[model samples]
Target: MAETILVTGATGTVGSELVRALINRGVNTRAAVHSIIKGDRLRHFNPEVQLVEVDYHRPASLPLAFTGVDRVFLLTPFSDQQLIINQQLVDAAKAAGVQQVVRLSAAGADMEPGIQLGRWHRQMEQYLEQSGLSHVILRPTSFMQNFVNYQGQSIREQGAIYLPLGEGRMSYIDAFDIAEVAAAILTDDVAKHHGQAYTLTGPQAVNHTEIAGIIGQATGRPVQYVDVPETAARQAMQGAPQWMVDSMMELNALGKAGHLAGTTPAVEQLTGRPPRSFQEFAQEHRHELMPA
Candidate 1:
């Protein structure tokens, strides 16, 4: 019998790509999405991919999704409630007798207890370890997809990338590569990766100025990276909850301190290939980054 894998956050950036990768490998895949309507994006894989509704807050809804699932790919959206939500899923997975769990976490998750996101992920990591289910914790560096998700409008309208990162260099990995790594671990022999924590990073580290140059070359436009003071960034993000603003500022402070810089071999070690460079990512998504 083939292993049946359940993927939570199945319509998201890494989850969506992981679903495709699993399907391509001819694995038994179930996509646990929040809503069947929004999951239509994954219809292309229908018949081959099973779609199930999952509500993290409501623990009662998770067991049915985990039925007969051999392993799980867990991802909870970033928020104040992430710890509670993921704990709910972990409890559900344990109850379902799932064999393994691969969690998508962030860099510094194990090291920086003071960072809000890192703290939350570490808490979940600890819980999963104690849950008695075999687990793989993937702590990937900054995502290259931030261009599209967070800074696309600024780049398109002003030809600039604005952040409070100062001159901090980050080895940002592509979301697709993170998915690839997850797929590899999920489909391969589970014993090799169980109880392991891997930090994923791109092949090279680059600062915002270098990224701006790469974007300019890719889109054939003059793009600039403007470093704003944390205070100015906080003012610009006015009206967002104070916690969110503080979290963003803390992350920037970490970046500016060179804490987020450096490459890791975990991606290559796991996938047997080097992670994608930011230049390649920018080039591939140039049309999207280019002014509309």
Candidate 2:
């Protein structure tokens, strides 16, 4: 019998793509979503999928979501409550007799005295390590999708990308590559990847200005990268929680320091293909980045 894999955060960016990847591999996939309504879209995409609403607020939902599941793909939302939420999921997975867990962590998660984002993810990694469950941690750098999710509006209206990154570059990975890596690990031998951590990244590093040029060349529009002051970036996020605002500023500081720069071979090692380049990402998302 084939193993049944449960994916938490199933409607999220990487989780949604993971569901598709798993389905493409003909794996038995159970998607644990917070909103059954949103999960209906997955059903439309593939009727063979099993959807279970897992409310972190409700303890009962966790067990039901893990029931009959052999392994789990864990991707938690970014927030102040991330550590606590991850603990809950880890405990639930432990009690459910799940064999392995593939955790979607952030790049630099293992850094000592790391920034807020890295510290939060590292804490979860430590917890998962202590849980005695087989696990694989994927620490992917800045996501290429952030261009569309966070800055697409600006690009659409003004043909510009704004950030406090300065000249710092990062090897931004496509969430599709992350999903494919996770699917490969989840379906392959657990003993091979057990307790392993992979730093997933794109084929190369590029700064915001270079990114702008790539998008412009791909879409046939002049897009410029505007390096705003850190204070201005903070002000732009005024509506967000104080913790989120502060953490984002910390990340911006890291980017400005060139700490997030570097390429890794983990994606290719696991997926058996080189990760997507920023140019490819820009071209594929041109519709979203182009002026409306």
Give the winner by TM-score: 2
List candidate 2 segments past 4 Å from native: none
**Per-residue lDDT of model 2, residues 87-111, tens digit only:** 9999999999999999999999999
lDDT of 2 at 15: 92
Distance from true position, residue 132, model 2, in Å? 0.6
What local lDDT does model 2 show for residue 225? 97
The window of 10 residues in a row where model 1 has the poorest summed lDDT is 39-48
Candidate 1 — which residues are off by over 4 angstroms? 45-47
Q: Model 1, 222: alpha-carbon shift in Å?
A: 0.9
Model 2 lDDT, residue 158, Cα: 92
- Cα lDDT listed for each candidate: 0.90, 0.92
